[model samples]
Target: MEGMDKEPWFFKDLSRLDAIRMLLAPGNTKGSFLIRESESNKGSYTLSVRDLDNNAGDTVKHYKIRNMDKGGFYITARIAFNSLSELVKHYSREADGLCTTLIKPCQTRIPQKPWWQDEWEIPRESLKLERRLGGGAVWRGIYNNHTKVAIKNLKVGTMSTSAFLAEANLMKNLQHPRLVRLYAVVTQEPIYIVTEFMANGSLVDFLKTNERRQHDHKHPHRHGISGKAQTLWLREWRLLKRGITSTGTCGRPTSWCLRTSSARSPTSASLASSRTTSTRREKVLNSPIKWTAPEAINYGTFSIKSDVWSFGILLTETVTYGRIPYPGMTNPEVIQNLERGYRMPRPDDCPEELYSIMNLCWQEAPEKRPTFEYLRSVLEDFFTAQKQQYQTQPC
Candidate 1:
């Protein structure tokens, strides 16, 4: 047994055809071998054998001997010309002939159930109508083409044409990053107010989507890890603060910073004074309540102070990820509560620091509400402190 284990295994008599047959057999037999002519044999054949198996098994014996000594018997099978080309042809034909006719068109034409069609269509129609009649489509500034543009055929008389003219003038004079830039006013049919397009759409749209996604099962709430929910609140606070602190720059912070610095400069101070006087004159000429003050809420007047109050409400909205200030409460109810000096409490998981800031903004007296500049400073401090604490804590 020891000697057998040490013995080298070899095929005894294997013809090339027999070797090929054994190789193609279903049961594995390791392999078979063939004898062939070598150059050294001149015309004699050489015993070029190989092992069939190293393991102990019932193996098939096969052989072929070719003479080189006199070249009497030469065996060469045309194995190279096998039917490999036939397989390629077979598949090519099958693929080309295969038909994939649908029994039905997958009901694709059944009209896709719009994810938000039910809730949004009516509101969207209302918005379009409001935009049409409220002089929203009226252009107010020059366009690149230098043509005075305005949307025409707007349900005219619904909104005073004088008011539209005033808005157009206001828009023309306005050059701030936060405020939409007015190029030209065109009063063609349907009124086309050409302004810079906001790729990010509106704050209202973002708020709606955020609210929907929060409750979507596909996107469950995940906490911590920079706390994205809290981060959104912080962002809202910053935006509100920016909008409040700067004047004549719309609602963008960067634009406000640029314009504010220039306006405060000595040379710009004279220009600023003139602009201020002009603005006061315009206010007297056109007492629009669209941008009214907080006091106006009671008396139907809009002011910067009232705008700040609105900002506070907006901040609350952001913190809650678009949750209504008073869920299940009607607008009348909300207004009544406001009249009674009522404010919504912060969401349960809201940071305490944020809650405090919101409370300050909701002060009964509009004048008592912290200015945007003050709010920004407070938020900066709070954020810095929180970051420091996070860094100091052990993992």
Candidate 2:
């Protein structure tokens, strides 16, 4: 019974089901174990170990430690230990009649940081909205009257301020280099989000503009970006898309493209612009049927896997230069077609490799979908293999 009072691994009140969940976590191994007070029997304990073989009675085997009327503990009839600590120590050394010997203590979870680390609030006076960027709530504004920025205004219901800020804090932490950097938030009557300005606008708009230029014939190649540059731009977005999907989040349509020195690429303040009480958020969450996964539309369930289905839609958008998905199909027909396994054909200029990735994303079963991390690595290798083609027209 050494240092029984100081073992943080001893979780006195954790339930049986929660112990199973922790032990079966992806990070856990076969022998990971914990001792918990038995729910049905007061003053007794249960030893839970993860043993994943089907031969074992259960994936997580639980053995009851019967507390003798005298001050001692025992699991098997032949073995008796004077203390709970001694019983645990003895069992760690050998499985004896139990399922498996304990290898490590159940991992103690680190408490999530409960508050925002840095201040995010800004005074309204610091941002100057110069002009409307589109016909929307966003405006081309100057932060501190000097730094050009895009400002988005969101109306908050009086009751939802805390929820809005909590979501904002999460967005601040997950800001990837590929995303539009969120500058400051104004917590006034109409909340304002200030983000770094992108002169060209969303990837959808930028790509459409170029697509039109190519179709015009007179200005067939006047988009000012080389073919190699466009390829690199899309490559960067594949990286960014992975980061976005890792968060398991979806947001309002953003001015996703940043006009890079070489070409137009996607970057977003979409995370910052998800204002919970606002009407815009309502529209975004109720995504058009074409953009939503079948599971999402049918069962109203969303997970990272569902987002993968949407990423397939985004892939089509990228390949076709932002053409509306399932063109000419009504929402009802779109859902019907999706249920019948109707996947979009590869766009005219999309490479076979890219189309294959889209197919992976559109897997009918959620568990069948590949993760964003897998997608990112695949794309990196794909681009590397094609590296020589872009070398001549270096951007």
Candidate 3:
């Protein structure tokens, strides 16, 4: 067989001046070049090109050019651009021209609402302590005539009020079905945050209830399990597992529980005071220390990846129907076991694919752990295929 003619190769590694020089070179107009501002770095741009005789289609070469005097260069990939000017225009809305290091402010900015105010407050008399959630206590209250919310009260002297406020600022921006909704913050001394109440309690308890219902021989309710409810269960699992990274805060709830209506949101209120040890707080709260990720336990460093590691532990707990992670193991024992590459055994009857995901999340190196978005995509596809297979089966 005759070999296919090789396509023209653009310079994959080029300085800002060199790339511009290439574009200005003779006969370079045959193909399109895409240029966009690099997302991770301001004043840096990514240039992607598709030659006239393209073999890879949208799979074009990418080069990062730092235009500033102190800027550097790199190579990356994405989609090809139609024209250099077009790419410049796209990025120009929020940045300077391709050759400059400055970025322009976006024309529109999201207005930050004042979360703490006396008018939006929950009266002390109306607040009733309900249950322990994270590092705080949730109190049931009527914020207004038709608004019933759970108030999360922070312990005095645990965290600075500024830290709490900063957390509230972040929390107020977050809105997702998998996350509990924040109504308002009572900024008064002994700060309290109001959020939507979930009646079904924690996710572990909810899953346990679901597991019992599945095994109930005397009262079969499989037919009563509406598609919506099943989807909701999957959603709850998705949110609890994947929603942390999306929030830009690696804040995972002390428990991966979901209420009937909402998943508990993580805030500074849920974070143990900087002065205290999480293990001590865990003991005080009577929450399991085994769920703490190895990195967190060993180095006291927490990140989004650390939270994902905790999710792996939570996955084991959920699949096992409230069974403890690292059962019969002390915190120190669990830490030692994990450092030596020991992971929890697969839950009985758990899907191999699901277990594989849990393993990915448990990678020893934080960077090696799979992202929440990737895991969610995998699970979504797997469940979709299962649903399709069932639908195609003969009645």
Candidate 4:
């Protein structure tokens, strides 16, 4: 009580006083004393002391004040003393209120509804052909809901509705650490495919942003080679590759390679002649033929093998930070090169092991391409090795 500015007191029933005495008895033995309120005071008091404990055997001494009104009472408490004086601290009235509230156990329980039951119903009119936003054959829009999900609506007539169903089915059946999760498929009206939102956007968006930042800063070509960038690119590529190749199906037929050697070659004269005759020359020339596998381009057929070839192009794009595989070449030229069995050149900075993997992925024969499982294992090993190297190096 030597530290008290004034005496402390509180009005309470006999039972409450007994409980407080029992709680503070241990502190009393350890040289604690209380300063009681002056007898003239009413419904107001401060409890200050040399030492006080809320509970027995606790080293911390609490200082507190209480005020009683007709309806309720307000109380505040703080640890006021410690052997290490430097460790003593104070708390605000709101903090003491929080401590008092937390002293009691919560009894409320609320059952959560299943996701399917709680999500919004898809509108049928939204799926109508005329309701499509973009003029192009494909409609792409973000479902601006709480989750901000993306939806791609391919023109029903351009590609059969089966294609959309196939994608949805594939998404549902697939399970990979890197693959985006398909939460639900609603076929009630316009088909709605629900998926988890990726807050950071796609790998494509990230690479584009990175490239823009690098150019804006006028940084050197090697500027983005930091460990963080490398790790991010590696992880993105691994996830993308896994998502595409997880299906056991092999793409385009092997026979496409046999015919590729003999496809009509486009000469400059032929290209020039076509340009003069056709208004669609540019569109014809800039088409995605080259990136398409020989079978897909020539026969209008595609399979998992063709998907692998596309994945290789995507991998190149990712590694080069959004650089097209063959810049300046027209679509026709790309197709011609593919027909001639010319693969895209690996980036100068690409690791040899990665280049080897790309070569396998870009194999002319679908059967010869490595499986996704095999690719995952190889990448895992590479990542593990890289991590070990990083750990061993001095910071």
Best by lDDT: 2
Q: Determine which window of 10 residues in candidate 3 has minimal summed lDDT.
A: 246-255
| Number of clashes recorded per candidate | 36, 3, 3, 8
Q: How much is 71 displaced in model 4, in angstroms?
A: 52
Estimate the overall C-alpha local distance difference test score of candidate 4. 0.40
Candidate 3 segments exceeding 4 Å error: 1-136, 210-212, 215-288, 392-395
Looking at candidate 2, the ten consecutive residues that score lowest on lDDT are 259-268
For model 2 the TM-score comes to 0.52
Q: Which candidate is the best by TM-score?
A: 2
Scanning candidate 1 in windows of ten residues, the lowest lDDT window is 100-109
TM-score of each: 0.40, 0.52, 0.52, 0.45
lDDT of model 1, residue 317: 49
Worst 10 residues of 4 by lDDT: 253-262
Ranking according to lDDT, highest score first: 2, 3, 4, 1
Scored against the true structure, residue 229 in model 1 reaches a CA lDDT of 24
The residue-by-residue lDDT of candidate 2 on 1-395, one tens digit each, is: 34654664476677876676556533356788888888898677888888856322125778898877777888876979888778778878998888788888876444333454235566788888899975656699987767778776764432256654554544444332234556667766677766656655665565567544454334222221222222343454442232222112211132132221101111123323444435433433444557677765665556678767766776676556568888898777787788798988888866787778889989999999987667666766666655544454545
Instruction: Kindly indicate the candidate among 2 and 4 with the higher lDDT.
Output: 2
Total clashing pairs in model 1 = 36
Clashing pairs in 2: 202-255, 202-256, 203-257
Tens-place lDDT digits, model 4, residues 1-395: 23433212222221222223322321122323232342345433323222213421122133334443433223332332321111112221223433221111111112224433222234434332213322332223344233334354444554445645555555543322233444444554355654433433444444456544554244232222222232343343432222221111111110000001001122233243443324334533433554455655554445556656655665565456656568888777776787799888868666666667678878988878766556656666665665575567665
